[model samples]
Each structure stands twice: as C-alpha cells, then as structure tokens.
Target: MSIQTKTVKAKTVAIVGGGCAGWSLAARVDQLSANTVTLYLKEETNPSHNWGFWQMPWLSDALSKKRAMWNSWQIITDEGIVTHHSRNHAYCSITSDDWFDWCQKRFHSAATTTEIIRLPVTNTDKNMLMTSNHKKRYDLIYDSRPPKADKNILLQHFKGLEIKTSIPVFNSKAAVLMDFRVSQENGIHFMYVLGYDQYTALVESTFFSTSPHREEVYDEAIRDYLSRIYNVTSFEIVKSEKGIIPMGDVRPKDQNPFLYSIGSNAGAIRPSSGYAFSFIQKQITQFLDRQTKPTNPHKKHDLMMDLIFLEVLKSHPEKAQRLFFKLARALNGDSFARFLSGEANIKDYFLVINSMPKWLFINQAVRVIIEKWKRIAKWA
Candidate 1:
C-alpha cells in the first residue's frame, strides 16, 4: 500500500447501495482519508451474506474480526469427504449484520463526516446518482447495485437458513464447503454448511440453472438435506438469505471509468463460479492501496474458459456435475479453493485445463475463434 506521508482526505464521495463493495469502500475511505462519504442503503434491505474467504493476504479489505471467523472447511461428494486445513490460510466469515454494524461504528467512532441514510436509488445516469428525492454529486461515485441478467443466463441461485439447533450438533472447527449429495434436478445442486459452533450453522441449498426456481424448491431441499445429512430434526431459523447471481457472461451495465462500478455490478463475480467475496476484497483493496484499480476482475483467459464450461452446462446439462466433480478430484483442496477464490496461478490454470475433457474445450475454443473471425470479417 502506497502510504501518503502527507495526509490528503478525498472529500465528498458517494457510495450507492450499502452492500459488500459499498461498505468496504466506505470503511476504507473512512480509515485512509477524511473523505466525507455518503452511504445510501436501499429501503427495507438488510446486508447480504455471512461472506467467508481465505484470511490471508486479502484479509485487509474483508473487515473481519477475531470474533467472526472459522478455521477450516470441507467438501462432501458421493465418493467421500475432502478436507483441507491450513493454519497460514485460515477460512473465515463475517455475518452481514456484524460487518455493516462495524462500518457504522467505524465511521461514527472516527468522528469523520460520513452520512449513511435509507435513500433508495431510483436510477443512475452517466455521472449522477438519482434518489427518490435529491440529485447528489460527488468527486467520485461508487455504484454497487447489481445489473440486469442476460436473456440466456444460468443463475447461481441459493436459499440458506442459519439455524440454531436445539441440541449441540456441529463441528464448529470445520465448514462443509460443498456437498453434492443432493439431487441435481434443476442443474448442479449442492448444499453448503457453515457450522459456526456445535449448535449453529447456515445450511444452504444452491443450484446453477437456466431458469429461476421457487423458494419452496430450495426450502424442501434444505429440509431434506438437514434431515438426511446431519440428522437434525429440531432447529430454529435465525436468519434466511436468498439470491440469484448470474453465471452467464453478462458484462457489468456500467463500466464507465469516472462512474465506478464496485461490486457484482463491477464484475467482481466470476462467470463460471459465483464467488465474489474474495474478488470484492481484492477490488476494493487495490483501489485503496493506490495500486491499479481492478475495474475488470475477470481476465480474458478466465472468461474464455468460463464460456466453454458454461457451454457444457447449457448444451449438455447432465455433464455439469461430472465436469465439476472431475475438476475437484483433479486439484487438491487448496488449489481448487485458490482457483475459485481468484488467486490461482498459471500452474493452477494448467492443472484445471488438463483435468477437463480436452475434446469439449477444444471444440468450444475453435467454434468461438471462428465466430470471432466471422464477425471481424463482416465488420471489415
């Protein structure tokens, strides 16, 4: 991080939508500079997820505390359980409410000029943030609102229930990262369990599909999963979170340099994998560190690979599970986690490329190249 010996506060910054990216930006600005930041929270919207990520190198931007963290995680497939424990790279999570509250507390404690209010943004123009009442301008406006999905999109949708069990029944030390024991009815379906303690955990049922499914579908799946996997008959739902994140290659709606797009709107989400917490931290961290701003987190190579992977999902939906299973089997836990977390090295990429069916990727790559050439020729 390039520390400015001469402290200069960036005054008047407006952050739309108090989501992960918005809060991260606001908190960083509050710490680094005296920037009078305005954080706009949409009406009747709570914070987003108990976002978990690797707690090293990128923890600076996560705003995680000792109180809100997990040490390890696991993956369960039809075959068996795959686990990884790294002291250097501990897995951690921060409840959305806790993080949001911390941000509020930070700005308040700092005695800086940070205004946070419930002003739902009606629309966003090129350079202006339109609210229900007033038109506000800032030196720089950071928008974290999600963009519209593509027509032919595969959404990674989920509904999770944070339950407190009546009896102590969880391994607080480890979290189930992915359990492929559930039926892949809509698409590749899995259940993720984040066990906070012996009696508390967030059990989530997630799917990747072309169309959206009802809450009942997820609710039923979660019930069945909890019953069969954990054998938990009694529990109280403390909190629930449901979201539909686009898995198709839909570019961010607003990519204008001056009018910054910071969260999912900024393409922090990977097209193939809908994991955004790590990338979100990376984006905000780079911006704050005076390093090259990560306006585009998805590299061209990653996008291309995702296109081929999504092709398999769209064209041959049945093969999606096998493809992912093979991928996991090929790479160790750390490598797979790193790849999913957007910290994969070239070797990791090569490992992924070599693991998948060569014919599928080669065919897709050739087809994409030909289509591109045809487009260029027509333009010429």
Candidate 2:
C-alpha cells in the first residue's frame, strides 16, 4: 500500500523601508509560518526620534520598553490650563533607536528565516525589486516608504532637544502636550514638553503649517521658550531630533495586489493630529489576524472628521488653541486617549463633535465636501 502527500513551499516576502512600519511588519512576519522575509533598509541605522502613543493591551510589550510614561498630561493656553489624568491608558514614548533594537532582538529570537539588507530600493517592476547592488523577486512586497508630499499640503514639523539642566526644575509628574505661550508668527505653533525627570526633559517647538520654517528658527524658539517659561538659560544639550510629517490625505501610488503599502503611505497618519504609531500597530494587527494584505485601518467617519477639522484649521488658524482646548475639556482622559488612538466609541465621537464650534464646523464640512467633489470631477 502507498499514500500520496502534498507539500507547499513557503512564501517569499520582501519589505521595503527600514522605518517603524517596515521593522514592525518584519518582526511579525518572522514569527509566522516558514515564510522567507527580506527587509530592505534605506540606511544602516535609523535616525533617532521619539514616537509617542498611549498604552493599550496589545502594546503592553512595547510599553515595557518605553523611555518615559506619564499618567497625567496638560494643555496650556493663555486662557488657562486643562489637565487630564488617565488611569488605564498612560501616555508613553519610545525612541527610534530603542524600537529598532527591540525589533532586531525579536527577529533573532524568531525561528523563521529573515534577512535584513541595507540597500535602497531604486525601482520596482511587477514583482521584482531592484536595488543598487541586487535585484530580487518575491511573492509579496510590503512598501513603507513615505509618500511624496503634495504641493501646498498641510504639514506638521518640529525640532526637539533633549536637554539636561544643572539643577532640578522640570515637573516630572506630567507632560505638557501643548504650551501656546510661545510666538504664533508661524501657523498654529506650540511647545511640547516631556519631562523625563527633574533634570532632564525634551522640549520641542512644533508647527502645523503649509511650509516648515528653517532649522535655526525652531532652535531659536526652543531657546526662547526655555528662557521665558522655565527661566533656565544654561542647559546641556544631550541630543536633538527633527522631522516633517505631511498632514493631508496621503494615498498609495499604485494599486498592485502583491505590492502593499503598509505605513503612512497608506494613510495611517491622522490628518488633524499627525499621529501614526498606534494606527500602524492597528493596521499590522488586522493584517495578521485576517492573513491578508494590509489596508488603511482608519474608519470613514473618523477620516471625514479629520478632514473637517483640518479644514477648520486651515480656514481659521487662530481658532486652533480654542478648538484643542474645547475638545480636551469635553472628553475625559481615557476618552481623549482613545479618540487620539483611533479607538474611540460613539460617545467619544459625540463628545468631539459637540465640542467643536457649530457654524465653523459646518462651514468647514461643506468646504471639504465641495473640494472632494471637485477632485472627483477633475479625475473624471
């Protein structure tokens, strides 16, 4: 007697871009079946930057490696300060260097064959990816390269400095999400502070605008902010980081089934808030659960709300502070965190809508609708 058996070959996966999304997906894929994965890194080492997100159950492992976590955070404006405290979802931050190290450790610990190559993907033809030194074909390709910025698109840009004071000064208990006491010459400017301890903190000068200012401009702002707000003029600069994130509708360039866009290129960023870490996590989670290609994980209604909010900011930049303050005041800490993390419930959504200025929102909503219609017509 004889029996016939069938065996299937493992899939070959190629992931482009070495940023958070690429590494995150590679780590997950390394744990799956016997898939052969190749992660292409544009650079040998990732630049250091802080990725901030709120704590959630699925992110408990990442949270364990957090550089800093705060149970309370505050938003400050000329009118007053609004403090929020969350017992369940603490705001946490992790640096890019640490995240890459963690992902690498996980990759090595996994029992699958995964190779990381430091090469920029120069071109792609069908299922083949061409690098400067090598060309390879794979069953699936996940591209996390940042989407090209559209002309005149809204942008969130910031430069941060990790400073150490000779004496204790910072309040380590809470984080300053937004301090609007700084100059508003730029569009929708604010200072964000994460006090790691009494002697150490990261102070960033951020702006939501169509164009970012020069690096020196942001540096001067940070200096002025520290001198005026903290009254500390002498501090040692430990490290610095700067980044520019597009805050508009960013879509994938192609619609190939085998080639999937996995990160901000697939619209993981919230247009209004410029937050993508949590959404990227959600996208990865859904992709793994369904055993399918990843798509944009944002809900339609939430995206629409973000569009309207962005329109409001574009039309009335002066109202930015008030809008943020009102929205923060309307929701509790948990609700606010959930809303920002894109896990808000109906009640949370309602609170956000109710907190906005009625006429302003209506006007912006109409504008967004008309703009979308015009785009469709132009395409047609």
Lowest-sum lDDT 10-residue window in model 1: 1-10
- lDDT digits (tens) for residues 79-182 of candidate 1: 66767666656677777767767766675666568787688877666556777788866666677877767797888889999999888887888878788899
Residue 249, candidate 2: alpha-carbon lDDT: 85
Candidate 2 Cα outliers beyond 4 Å, as residue runs: 1-10, 44-46, 253-257
Best by lDDT: 2
What TM-score against the true fold does each predicted structure earn? 0.86, 0.95
Clashing pairs in 1: none
**Count of backbone clashes, every candidate in sequence:** 0, 0
Clashing pairs in 2: none
Model 1 misses residue 140 by how many Å? 1.9
Candidate 2 matches the true fold with a TM-score of 0.95
Question: What tens digits encode model 2's per-residue C-alpha lDDT throughout 1-380?
Answer: 11111221237778898788888877776544546888888864435889899998768657977999999999999888999999899999998888878888887677778898888998887778899988988867788988876788889999999999998889888999999998888889999999999999999999999998999999999999999999999999999988889987886665554467888978888888898887888888787776666778788988899989988898899999989999989999999999998889999999999999999999889988998999999999
